[model samples]
Target chain A: MTAKISPELPERLVAAALAALERGEDVGLRALARDTGVSAMAPYRHFRDKDALLAAVAMRGFADLRDQLLAANAAPDPREALVAQGQAYLAFARARPALFRLMFAGHDGGPPPIEDNAYGVMVRRVRELAPVSLEAATLACWSAVHGMATLALDGGLSPDGSSVEHAALKMIVAGISAAKRS
Target chain B: MTAKISPELPERLVAAALAALERGEDVGLRALARDTGVSAMAPYRHFRDKDALLAAVAMRGFADLRDQLLAANAAPDPREALVAQGQAYLAFARARPALFRLMFAGHDGGPPPIEDNAYGVMVRRVRELAPVSLEAATLACWSAVHGMATLALDGGLSPDGSSVEHAALKMIVAGISAAKRS
Candidate 1:
């Protein structure tokens, strides 16, 4: 749009968009371009439309989550590590509700499948435990945590309330045992 | 904005909006009003804004899901009924992906929590079965099923191709059994 304000226009666009999403603000290309201190039409050069820009933001979200998941492996015990992973997932969701929603809302084509993303790390963790029914264990653990993450965000869980870690620990243990039984 | 042509303009607006959403098209007030064959501003009278309209649609979604859950209770056995409920949940999501997403996506202040909505029905059903740990069982079954529904929508599950219904059934059955053990 003008003399390139920054060579990293694409990166800056997505970063600003992510910040907007995290702040519970709408992400529009024009708004993003302005936020990034770029020319009004600068975003259009990198992203086809608003949808494309949102997709890039979600991609960055998954990358952020991947790091968090990997970092959650701070325990020596596999079980503790598994539980930590669950907590990390929920914590990520709570900390960045809008961005987290964007990641799974299919808002921009459902965030692309990243090979080193959180889900991939989760599957590997489950396999290490060697449950009787890997499919059942994996789905059960993932779904249960995913559900709670969303539920927690909505404050939709029982009014009595419990921590995500406390709740996730119970479900993960139950789900893993269920697989073991199978 | 034209003079009211019909008394049911609000209902018609939501219906048209729901239709637009289910068809994988974006919902816009002006577009919805046009689609409903009403005045360009007719939707504004019923809903303060686009978010309000989306929230209303989500409310309708929960009500619809409640009915389906009840209908799924045709089975006499409680355990069978539980599995039936899980299947019904996924069926509802598959049949109405947009509304299903709307139900949980928290559109425009999110949908109001209905007393007789699907989640309430789910809690009641789970309590009736009397699981070992009500909270844990509820979270596990709900999360597992919720996970499967969203995962199936995104095709985010294991590539081996187990159907969402199949995976949900296993986790639900196992969850209930675990509760029974507790």
Candidate 2:
């Protein structure tokens, strides 16, 4: 057979893409292959094209998010866990704006179903918090959290530079509580 | 002399741009001029370039938003007015998504300042209700609203086909009340 087998080539390529994103440089397939210490063609074997490559990178983002939210969910204090999850969402965006954008970015072919992705983690957490199927309330809470992340990345949050996550969480808690009120 | 003194040229062009956006057609100065029934060069005189034109369009958007919020602010009941304003924000987004997107779209040159823009209107309304400079609270509220709108447009608000506004408003009310509690 071949000289040897390594960890999945696709996973390695996605990891390289993440590293490239962190470095604040362009992440073409060529660069990714080199970063992985593989031949330029190595990425092509795993990915159909740039779109496929980006899609793979987005999967990793979801996995990371799932891990963060699950850890947050484990917190003994329910309220603290909710806030923790919200904070983790913001932290992910701040730490890796490129990946965050890619995770949510619309594609020409439309986004893959979120049912089994990181979104599932969010849905499960929301259901646990809501208990009832107050879908609107859930949507509203999600919107608030998403908006803060977007505002921060787009410079919409005031530059007074206070704690963005704290502000965002307060709003989320309020939205959820208000939904329950009504 | 001009056949008739129409609304000012820039105003006419901005209107044309809005119309073009509604049709989901590409919006270039040339297309706008043609749609507005003006000479191709007419818009150029009023705008430095496409960016300038987009800035003008965004200004118009802010003006419209300001008017809507102002009317909401005049409601007899404070809480009712707050919900009314939030509803108006959603209605504006739903009715004019393209204009709304343009209002927030990133520009390489950086977006124009929000002095006396739709944001100022939001800040004024928020301050009137809060009576304190809890900037973080304000940001949280805004983020939530923005996120909901984005999710709805991007198809991330779940596929339940319920009243998005109802869900969104409940959360907003809760957030405001909670902020007051703190």
Chain B TM-scores per candidate, in order, are 0.84, 0.78
Per-residue CA lDDT of candidate 2, range B1-182, in tens?
56446678888888888888888775998888887887788777878888889987877887787787777667765556666767677667777877776776654353643326556656655666565535765676677667766666666654455465665665665566556534
Stretches of candidate 1 exceeding 4 Å from the true structure: A5-7, A107-115, A130-132, A158-160, A180-182, B1-7, B108-115, B128-132, B158-165, B179-182
* Chain B fold agreement for model 2, TM-score: 0.78
Highest TM-score, which number? Answer: 1
Candidate 1 docking category? Answer: acceptable
Regions more than 4 Å wrong, model 2: A1-60, A71-74, A112-117, A159-164, A178-182, B1-16, B28-49, B110-117, B158-164, B180-182
Model 2 TM-score relative to the real fold: 0.74
Q: Which ten residues in a row have the lowest lDDT in candidate 2 chain B?
A: B106-115
**Once model 2 is optimally superposed onto the true structure by TM-score, how far is the C-alpha of residue B94 displaced, in angstroms?**
1.9
Candidate 1 deviation (Cα RMSD): 3.1
